[model samples]
Every structure is written in structure tokens, then in C-alpha cells.
Target chain A: MTVQKVWSLFDRSQLYECYECSKCSGSCPVTLAGDFLGPRKILLKCLQHGSGRVIRDPLLWYCTTCQVCQDRCPQEINIPELLTGLRNKAAKIGNIPERVKFTVEKIAKTGRSVLGFKVERERKRYNLPPVVEISKEEISKILAETGFFKDLKIDH
Target chain B: MALRYAFFPGCVIPAKYPHFESATRAIAKVLDMELVDLPFSCCPPTSNMKLVHYDSWLALAARNLCVAEEQELDILTTCTGCVSTLKEANYIMRQKPNRRRKINRILEKAGRHYEGTIEVFHLLDVLYDHIGLEAIEEKCIYDLNMKVASHYGCHLFRPSYIMYPEFLSPSHSYVPTSIDEITEVLGGEPVKYMRRFLCCGYPLGANVDEDASYEILREKLYYIKAAHAELIAVACASCFEQFELGQVMIKKKYKETYKLPTLYISQLIGLAMGIDNETLGLKEHIHKIKKLLPRLQERTGRMRATL
Candidate 1:
């Protein structure tokens, strides 16, 4: 997606209204946690250097997408949504994280995000009913229909 | 009328933390809340699938909602992450016709369709709003006078517009007190503490950055400990896991022991309602509840003796 296309995904008014106020960064847990570039700086970078530059930054993955920054934004700028859109674009280009890839593959293979073998053992000890099963074929079909396998370049 | 819901036990509760599932089921039985089981998948985990592909996230979440919709039941989720993803997807599908059509096209391939016919709720919502605090209070056998620091995991009410419409008032989302009120009704003091509204950092720490995640956990723990809270109560399985496991990491890395026993809201309520620790899966927790368990037992024993 082009820089213009990226900005167009959001309400342009919300984007333009950003007065460089640092409240987003100030309220951001990821920013407060450590040496990561905060949301305010990220928005500024996207505006100046384009979404491509910001998407490639390792700091982009650090956002927990907790939505705190967006909630606290005076201009109501949806930082989490913007970050998600950027991440989607990054993922399409195969700039995704390994753990994220693993999670998606696991979900595609099994019907859940995490493996259920250990859960099966634990539930037996507790005498709980076995987990309800969903068709893995159906899950993969949905992913393939959504172009997930294509976008992430994961072989089904 | 007995309230019935399709229990949407998200991936984490069953796959990683079955104890949470056990406690929720036990509590549902006491409250007479019928939790119908369904073949459900991950809530697609907002931090993972949503970030990777918006359409896939919506499609997967929509599929789960479709499963519940076919049974003609609303979803009651134990994990806050599932609540957010499924609720947000429902909101988007309901409010936007074009988006719904686009997703339905994908769903058509799987022989499923989401008519947006159902609502999604966190277990806390059903407990506080539908079940009523007075009803819960009446069932309490042990009066827990312990100090509890309630963690209302972020996904429960953030992005206020889509979530809990009642929290649309600007200030309401800023200071959520449903869990606090529930704690009070259970005969426990919901202690005031700083950093109550912050995210638990599980999304970051679990997948992306462990160090940064620990930093966030340490800050939240510092405030809860300073408040002299005897135990931590969490509404989300991810946060419960983070608090329990984070403390172990903090002990090993920082050499500081906060030792606050983190309990799922259901487990905490179950204990006060005279449920046994073994049934609630208290033994599965990383932090030892040795001290708190004895105190609860003592209170119940005294109450029994008086009777």
C-alpha cells in the first residue's frame, strides 16, 4: 500500500488533528516500558517518512495494541488501528515475527492457537469433559478463503 | 428464568490454563447459569491474527460467532481477549454492511454465515449486570475480609465506543469499578491502588518482548504491593497467567518477591461461596495460596461451628 493509501485508511481529520501532543506516548505502556519509540514519535514518523519507514522499524512490533494510546488521545486518533494496518502491510511483505508466524500456523493446523495435548491431560486429571472439537479442514478453508495463507506465505 | 449462554472459553483458558475453565464451570453451576458447550476456535487473539490480517481475524472471529448464533445463544467468554476480538468483530459486522458482506463471502466458503444475531459478554458482565451483586452476596458462605487488588484487564473496556455501550460516558471507561463492586459484595475490601487501569503487558511479553513486558508487570506489582493487598483478582486468563508467572520471573530475575496470590474472579467468588480449593484448581497456580487458603478455611470452620 502506498503512503497515501495508508493515511486514507483512517479518518484524515483525526490524523491531521494530531498537534504533536505527546499524551499518547505519555500514556503508552510500551513507551513507558523501555527504549522503544513511543506512539507520538511513530505517528510523526509515518507522516514525515511514510508508513513504509515506520512499518520496517522493529519498534513497530512492540505495540501491544492495548488501545490505551488511542483511548487517551485528545484528537481521538486510533493509534492501535493504524499500527494494525501497518503491521498488516508489513506482514504481507513477509516482515512478520517468527512467534506470530508460529501462532498462525498452529491455529491453521489445529483449530486453536495453542496445542491441546497438555490440556487434554490436565482436563482428564480434573475429570472435566474433553474439549469440543472443530474441523481443522473448516479452519483451513476459512484461512485460505481469507487469503491468509497467501498473505503470510504459509504453505497449507 | 435460568440464563443460558454458549460458553466461549477462548484458546488460552483451555490450552494454557484449564484451571481457569474449571473454576468458571464450578461457579456457573452454583449460580445456576447454564453454559452450553460449542465447537469454538481461538478468538483469533487480537495481538496475533488481527495484526497480521484484519480480514482473517474478522472471518475467524465471525465463524465462532456464527457457531453460537446457530445455537441461538449469546457468547459468554472467560478471557477478556476473546471478549474484545469477538465483540469488536460483531460490532464491525453489525454497523458496517459492506464489511459484513465481505466477510460473509469468505464465510460462505466454510458453509457458515454470521447474521450478527447475538451479543458477546465477558463473564464479569453476566455476573455484575445480569446475575446482580445482591444475588451473588446471598450465596456467600465465607465472608472474605481480605484486601483484594482487582485487575480489570484492558480488553474488558478499552476503545469504549465498541465495548460496553454503558461505558460510553467518557469518565466511566476511565475508572471502571464493576470488579471492585463485585469484590465488595463478596465481603472483601477492594483496596485502592495506583496503576489499576494499565494493561497487564501479556500481549507484549508473551509474544514480542519479554523484558519490556516484565517492566510493565513490575510497575503494576509495585503499586499493588505498596497498597498492602493480600491477593490479586483478575478477570482475564492472560492477566491471571501474567501476574502468577510474572511474579516467579521477578523473583528469579529481580530477587524481589511480591508473592501476591492472583485469583481469577470466578475462583475468588467460588472460595467465598464455600467451594473447595481443589475444585477451583487453586493448586495449579504458580503463587502458593497456602496463607490465604487457611484463612478462608478458618472463617468457614468458625461459621460452621456457630451454626
Candidate 2:
């Protein structure tokens, strides 16, 4: 991947406190789940070559973002969020995962999340949280559901 | 007194998030208050900012504050994230003129200059401040009798700039203040459920395994369900969205667990105002608060008979 101008402009010092802390690696549920996520490797990449190359790593997609790292970080590096920052930068440069694209498409085609239910779960329980569907007519006006349903390919 | 203030229901509630809008409007009307829509755009600080482009996130939040400022009313929002984003941006702009100028410069190209004048508040702040407990009592038609838990999402109260004076702690002691005062006025019991003030896992919107996105709420709901509260109340939109959307996901993922009902402060107040579930946008929800329906019907029936 070509070097992006944004990489050079970012505040490098903002995320510089992790002293090879493996606590975040120890705590991350995603890391435990056999995903390629751990704070030690992440901190090494970020420090050695700058975040530019780290942003392009496909393995960065495996974060569950439980923030167990933030919970347990002795150095308080917010490792998961740093990874999220890298992923976000990558996304701007065209790096969304295929599964995410699928979910987005499903939401676009349907009004709700991909987990759109046939039975209203709100009705299943005695307690309901305040949620309502977006009306179709209203949705058409804003290209409203499109961004959420990035998986779908309607012209609008 | 003539009751009128600028109303700024963000992108979600008015269209897709109608339940919140309907209930809020109902409660606003019963208080004899008028909410003038601020016609602002999204604060756009979430998935789009911090993670994506921090500058655009701040700029989007700034654009929203500018629109609300033009109206010169304390911008009252249904969404806590919007309120926090706008308020934080307003504070940022006030404290750092140089950064504000750069953000304003981007806005100027788009024909907007953010002056950092408008104050942003979540719906709870307005209900507590403008319509005091006494006012709510006067307008309340239903004594709900619900034992409620409160969810204060991080963006609303965390940074202290946007939170009420008393609730500044993460393990919030003042969890029950907003819902308690309103519930007490409406003749309900206020109960402290476990983890009453934790994040609702809403911040994980932009990820895969979105069901697992609810990993945080399991601990939260376990504590809440343990308290045996009849219902939960919230002051934040993303939290409410998380609770309502994640209830079934939480139940299924966590293995046959039950959760109490959830309500935004507006919906609860709407019940107090004699607004029916249909008009309050309850039909759109798959999560059922059927427990409160009969109580609400009885109140409506009594009011109609008296008339």
C-alpha cells in the first residue's frame, strides 16, 4: 500500500505509554479466541514503523472491543482503541472486511440490523426499551439507511 | 407561563427512532411546553469520528452546535451522544480558539461559522430543570408504581461538562436521581439495581460479531435483573438503543435470562401524561413492556370516566 499523507500528520505521542504490557493481551477475549490481536505485538508495530503500516494489517480486523485492555492495562494504553484507530484510518483508505459489507447490505435491504427479527423481542419481555422503526417513506428521502447498510448496493 | 424552547431531536428519533420522538412530544405537550425543532444535523462524532477522522468528527459536532446556536435556545436533544458531542465541541471551541478557528474555517467554506454560544442538554436535564418535580406531579395522570433502574450512558455524564452536577462518578451514586425524582412524582418505587450506571455496549456499533457487541450488557443486566426492578429508565439514546435492541440478543446469548423493561425518560413521562402506547410509538418495539400497559389503560379509563 502507498504511504498516505494522513499517517505522517497524526499525533504519534498521544498513544506512547505501553511498556510492552502484556496485560491487555492477557485480558482481550478476542485474543483468547485465537484472533490475531494482542497489545504487545500491536505496541511494537506502532512504535517500530509508525501507525502507517499497522493500519494496513488485515489481522487488525479481529478486535472484539470488549475494552478488557482498558480495564486491565497497567500502563493505561487503551490498546483496543489504538487498534480501532488504526482500523478506522484503514477504512478511509478502503479496507472494510467482506463480512461487514455483507451485514451493511442486509441492513440496507431491510430496515433493521441483519438480525432483523420476525418476532418482536420487545414484546417477549415485560420490560421494553424505547426503540422504533424508521419509516420507509422517510428513509427514502435521506439515503438514510444506506450508510448503515453498506452491504447493500441500491443506487440511492 | 408560556412554555416554549428550541427542540433538537437528532437524526434517529424523528424518523427511524420515532418511539422516542412520540413519547417526548407527548410529555412535552402535557407539560404545556413547545419544542421548536432546531433543524440541526447529526453530531457525527461516533463511528465517523475519533476512529475514522477526528477532525471531521469534531467538525460535524461543531456544525450541529452552530445550527442550534443560530436559534439561540439551549439546544435540548433526545440523544445523549449529540448533547455531549455538541456541548464538548462548544466547550472545546470556547477553550481553544485556534482549534475552533480551524474547525470554523472548514464550516465557513460550507457557509457556517460556529460561535460556541448555544448550550446543549440531554432530555433529562430539561425535564429536571424546566419542568421540575412539582410540575411533573401536576401534569402526571398515572401513578406508574414501577420499580425502576437508571442507565446513565458515558457520553451524557462522564466528562462532567455535559453531566448534571451531582453525577460525576463512573460507579455513579446518583444513579437514581433523575428517574427517582420523576418516578417518585409519578408515585413509583425507586430501586437501585446492580451495575445501574454502566456502559450499554452501544459504542460497539461499528464491528463484526455485533451480538457479542452486547458483551458489556450481560454483566449490567445480571445486576439489574437481580435488583428485581419492574423496569429500567434511561437518559441516553445510544444506551436506550443498546438496551432495547440488545434485550433479546442478551437473553439468547446469555442463556434464557430475563430482563426488566426499558424506557427513555420521555416514554415514562409520556405514560404519566396519559399518552397511549400506540401514540407513544411503542408498537415499533419488539420488546414488550406489557406490564405497564394495563396500568396505563386503567389510568386512561379513570380519566375518561371522570370527564
lDDT (tens digit, per residue) of candidate 1 on A1-156: 111134434554566678987988998888878989888988888778878788777677887778888788877788887787888888877777888888878887787887755778888776678889999899999888888887777888
Which structure among the candidates has the greatest TM-score?
A: 1
lDDT of 2 at B194: 56
Q: Tens-digit lDDT track for model 2 on A1-156?
A: 112234333345645776665876775544543546566777788888877787787666656433446545655454544664676567666676665544333333333332324234432232223333434332232223113223123344
- iRMS of each prediction in angstroms? 2.3, 8.2
Which prediction has the highest DockQ against the true structure?
1
Q: Mind giving the per-residue lDDT tens digits that candidate 1 earns over B1-307?
A: 8899999988888877787788788878878789999999888988888888888888999999999999999999998899999999999999989878988988998899889889999999899989999888777888778899999989888878888776566543455788899989888899988888998899898678888898899999999999999999999988987898899998889999998999999989988887777778888777877787656533443232110
Model 2: CA > 4 A from native: A1-54, A57-88, A96-156, B1-3, B161-176, B250-259, B294-307
Report the TM-score measured on chain A for model 2.
Answer: 0.65
DockQ per model, Cα: 0.66, 0.12
Candidates in order: C-alpha RMSD to true structure: 2.7, 7.3
DockQ of 1: 0.66
| Candidate 2 CAPRI level | incorrect
Candidate 1: the clashing residue pairs are none
Local accuracy of candidate 2 as per-residue lDDT tens digits, B1-307: 8566667666555545556776777677667777776545545544333344445456656766766677776777887766766776777688877777767766775566887666777778778887788878776667787777777665665444234445534532123267677877777778886555545656544454565457656667777877877788887666777787788886776674565677888888777667776766666666668856676423444341110
